[model samples]
Target: MKKSTRILCNGALATAVIAGLSAFASGYLTGAAPWPASGLTALATANGPVAGAPSVRKTLLGSAPAQARFDRIIVRYQDAAQTRSRPASVLGAVNAAATRAGLTGSRALAGHGASVLDVQHVRRLATGADVLRLSRGLDRGETDRLLAELRADPAVKYAQPDYLKQRLDFVPDDPRFDLQWHYTHPSAGIDAPAAWDTSHGDGVVVAVLDTGYLDHADLNANIVAGYDFIHDPDVGGDGDGRDADAHDPGDWVGGNPSSFHGTHVAGTVAALTNNGVGVAGVAFAAKVQPVRVLGHGGGYTSDIADAIVWASGGHVDGVPDNADPAEVINLSLGGSGSCSQDPVTQEAIDGAVARGVTVVVAAGNDNADAGFFSPASCKGVITVGASGIDGARSWFSNYGATVAVTAPGGNATSGSDPDDRWIWSLGNAGTQAPLPSPEGDRLMGMIGTSMASPHVAGVVALMQAAATEAGRPPLTPAQVKALLRGTVKPFTVVPPASKPQGPGIVDAAAAVHAATQEIPVDQGELLSNRVAIAGQTGAAGDARLFKIVVPAGMRSLNLRSYGGSGDVSIYIAYERVATPTLFDRKSAKPGTGEAVVITQPAAGTYYLSVVGESAFSGVSVLGVYQ
Candidate 1:
């Protein structure tokens, strides 16, 4: 059946841009070992599922706050201060800028931590940048003028207001978060809450190209105007052909009811989250554009192709230009046949990729090779397979080389306890048409590869949004696919299917953090041998790496990391990076602190790595040698 590819609805699964938190909040990715030759590996962990701890829920509404005032500014000079006594040249430039901006009482204080400034030294960065504080917070205009004056000085390389940073380790107040084991499970889940600390997919838009969306309070707020691309009136189910209205009229046929498949998928990608309502979406702050292509007896390849182009900002002959074009497109619907045999669909995917849109598609549910599916077999698109709560490939998901990654798509076997294994999201109760009353709004648990595709799409949106918030350019389609394939979480068990299920499960926190550019490590800063640096890492399964060199005369070396919330494991490797699975010296305890000492240590480069057993913060990595 070419119809939206028969997703099992009976209790089965399916499927941030802000001033991002510091790069360390999610941890920076260092060059690491490549995926195993077989491509996919099972995650070998001793941890079990986490029990739910539902908290008091609250919602925030109203317009956003006004522009912020600044009382501190970080100024970097062309030269470093060799001595602690504030350099005379640096003092003169600061005084000059203060005077030019009509400010008084400017003097350089001792460099350290936070302190009020008439004009004073805050602290010196490893790169020799100076943090300066003002007497009081200045309004936007005054701060701008002050920055301009500071930048005008020949000695000043750069100057900008020091923005206050909030903790990025956010836990949403959504009541349903407790029910979402697919997000909270330490070994099997995606670790989305910790990633939320970095970004909320703020400005990115994801187009859900499938059956049209239905009206539901949980999803309506994040939805934008989308076009109906069902060319045939019979297929559309509506009285007319393609139109701007993307509302689902239902696609019931005899005994089967309307799947409301697209609504569920869109909800997974981006439902109104943290609203103290029903469920939370992966990229809740992102907008979902509903481009209806599947309907009645299923949609034509031609219709799906045109919808892809238009949603990605390309123009169709009679369709209007998409104003809020999507940065990501989720096709939770697919058909049989190789991509080469479907030239139009392949061409459309190519065009979308050229336009810089990341295309994500389902790897079908035929329990066969994904290489035989249309969009999944198509090049330039991310083919997503389905996995259950156990982190194994879902029983019905398509597999093989073409599948890029697996996501939580739920599994409801006939006699097994599938209640906890289903993917939960927004849905409607109407069997064949739009249900009347708010009572029609529903929350459902479904299982299928159709459900898994949106999970990857949501992660892509988070990656793009985090990149933008971090002041980095959006990743190209190729880069997005690579990032996803590179940052996946290993399945807990190998798939029993004959073929492999691509790389592994998609990890939201890992992928989002990896999307940000890593800050270059400076070996020069570690010459003192006795230094402590503050660092952080996202949810369990996320990791950070640090490199240090030992001098020849050192008698002993101590490496310690302490004072962090949440559990973490530390690993030490000689001359190379270490991971949870590959490390020389290791500490895999339950606490936040880990210590390892080396007596008569060899003189060479050493790698210290911290792998999170859970989200951690305020950790101090100390290195000392005597």
Candidate 2:
């Protein structure tokens, strides 16, 4: 991460919010503050937080919705079984409810004027019961009244306005995609080009919770409708706070105008690709939901927590239910606190995971252990650290046991070449020299765990899309984390101080490949001259079986075994049907390393099985034929 030499304190901005918006501005400074310098290295002090960096302000404008439209409602019967059996009964019930709500109006028949109840069209939801579209125009009050009347029906399950969902097409013609080394570079980047061959992330929505977004030619089309959770106008910078518009105005402090951090993060996840204009996105076809929680100086933990719930399709007071909930949530911000001491953030993450939303958080840029951070230390999140072009830990990345994976966050260390080390993404020209108004979009380079996290999120989008295409169930957050850890490419060189960099740098190609693989048979086994398998036992008496073929002219079979943090035993049987006992070649090693070799004798199929000495033990086995 590159640290700026200049740092300024915006006392006036902090004082203004402290006076007028105490509730929203609590526990945080007003201006864009950088993370405090650490003792790790002199260059470590150069990088600040990856968000809201010092830059000139740019007046990027976005158009607002013309008028609110309320002309439809989604209705599902209370008893799905009954509704499926008698569809007509539910339709009749809806008509009766509309009539009782005084919304009846009809056309004349045969030159005679007569009134009739309005019934425009009824459509069935793919998974639910039905959604009714009323006549074109209706006010909020009228729609609410009609919904209330429908809810009065005992048979009606749920009745709410069918909110408008706009599709922003994300197709960029940006020509700078070729310069994005982080996508295709061999040693320094996640192999995005190879992963793209399998999936382009269609049918997946990723929620980006950051300092909101900007309207850029390269990014607008792929954005979905999202909400602003910044409750203070000072921090929000949009004059008013916490409204429907999620467009970022600017988060300028004294020294830093604004990082446009949210926009950069969004572009990394799903920027417009192959439109002949800008850089390509990791998941080019995935939609992004920009949920604003950070603005102005910085955001509060409370507002960020609420955004998580709303983004995951959970209800919050005074906030409308999300029409397009995300399958993946990316949070690129963090504060200095342990998750164990921060239950508010932890609970929100827990809730999001319970609802099947995979949350990916940055491991922070503090050059310290991530265990001291809030969301990164949270149990269920896929905490990510940053690596550089050389695939070494970024100078400013946080590390610890909690980190699940690492990605290319770029390095701006002293003497590091910018062309080879920087992560380039969409940004405002104002972030460069000579502060200007009305910021025009440009490409900028940055380095931090903040940058590394979105790579994982984008790869998750690819995995989810592939899983859907393969007609398989979506992976749970735990499963997603497992796939990421299990498939990472080992580091070419071990990191300094033996820091736990998870399994290795995240491998997008391997993750997607694992997600889309066909479900394995219960007793299926891998075949090769040498085979290695790693797994964990579920409960007591749980056993995993593998079959190996010993050809007629085979020389010898060799086996080695190891257990992780628990007791496990390996058994080999030459017979076709009988379960092997201790009488057979059983190696019940006390721990870790155990080995057994069979002489060149038999030539048929043999079974190798692993059984846990106790519940939940981890095991690894190696089979070799010579």
Candidate 3:
């Protein structure tokens, strides 16, 4: 995030709420101020203690709806008056302290500035090295001990976990899926390419932002059209507009620290293979467009916001717009927060949602709750949290009511979910000679939801592919989200597990079939939110996508996955990038299960793409608004 934060929500202006109340009672009484626990509730944080979910038979949706009420405690180097001149010393200091204090995770670097080496915004102390955003930990003893330690340390400027806040809604796991993936890969469930020959994400064009693509034999044909977004960072590359794709090293060499993420993300969405060697993507036929935004010192918030608009086929002053519109946009990066909305962040997301595009975002690696990040907490876009193949929340994933559906985004101990981990994909050699004969082929092994997100995107492409071929209008982002949400299956993970929700594992076979279908909500189906609720109740292949009819008089809908106890917490959905946004939205009821509010111009048929909280079951009710 840039230092000049604006146009989004609140706490985003400056990541500076971390220095409050680490002092003692006397210290608090003297110089410290009172905490606004009540107001803070507006921006809530985590609830399951730390690094886990609640223990229950059915996972409940939304984190009790209270995480949004907490005040956000942001922390950053005061010296960072401007993002450009943030100062490296501050980042160095923070990293030194973090390492000394024993905070383990990705090591920090002087990527953003000088005086401000690095900054971290957290929802709970469950993760991070130095700074944190902790609300009152239910355990008084634990809270007190942590407070004492923070105050005792001189380097620790100040601490306050209970006062500030932020809000994270529904989000999810991987990228859009590949089209042809359903074929060959049994997980996708399709027996052969012919099974999907009638349709696949062929009509869908997905843009992959990263280093220059290899233009390999299998991949060359699938690429619809692309441009180089990478302007080259000093650390690597010829800084050329489109250097002939060459030998890129590391799962990330040549590609700036920023570009590497894009490549990793691409493989997850569309790697190639059916003809022979390597892994298969969710939607192999979907077009892959590469956009390079993260080239140097991370990227500026402005560039990303622009990318969002561009990715959706919106015009950008200088950059070439994504000629073809995408139904979904995926984001896997963010700054800290305690559930507080950043105006700057919101605007960008709002702009995207305003269009018909559905945005998919990462819930965060904070491993605490969805109330931890900025844009992911936005109300509209789909906010995704990571999970293990075992159906448990990844130890590194942030869970809360905001989370939509969970996908296999490898964990801290492992990488992508075992089912998809080390899965082969086309290689991205930054800029080196081709394979076997300088112009040959090879594969790359990578991880992270950055890698997983494309899988989801690929699925979206196939859904679009089916819609196009079947003589139906292409689905809006909302419709796609609804389809994917209600289709997820339940997988279980017990204690000693790092993730809160186990894999719940995605079923590509199921999703591909669902994509081939076009559930038409005719005139008769319109005006009411009552779809043989009982008969319409069954999660398809995605686990996250479910089917429900809008009941009459019910304007709003609420789907919760309630866990029986604290020892075991299942999730329904991970987060929502924004509000009232989706691939499709029929008449929905006013939330709170009270009254119903209809949004469709007139009473008509509508379908909700199911977004899971943890592992939902039981009365997944849809209310109609009056």
Best by TM-score: 2
RMSD of each: 24.4, 17.6, 18.5
Model 1 ranges off by over 4 Å: 1-178, 518-626
* Model 2 quality (TM-score): 0.58
| Candidate 2 residue runs with Cα over 4 Å from true position | 1-178, 414-416, 431-439, 519-626
Whole-model lDDT, model 3? 0.40
Tens digits of per-residue lDDT, candidate 3, 253-308, equal: 23211123444455456555353423455566676666544332222233344456
lDDT of each: 0.66, 0.64, 0.40
The TM-score-based order of candidates, best leading, equals: 2, 1, 3
Model 1 lDDT tens row, 32-79: 111111111011111311234222222111111222566666666666
The model with the greatest lDDT is 1
How far out, in Å, is residue 258 in model 1? 1.0
When summed lDDT is taken over every stretch of 10 residues in candidate 1, the lowest stretch is: 19-28
How far off is residue 34 in model 3, in Å? 36
Best-to-worst ranking by lDDT: 1, 2, 3
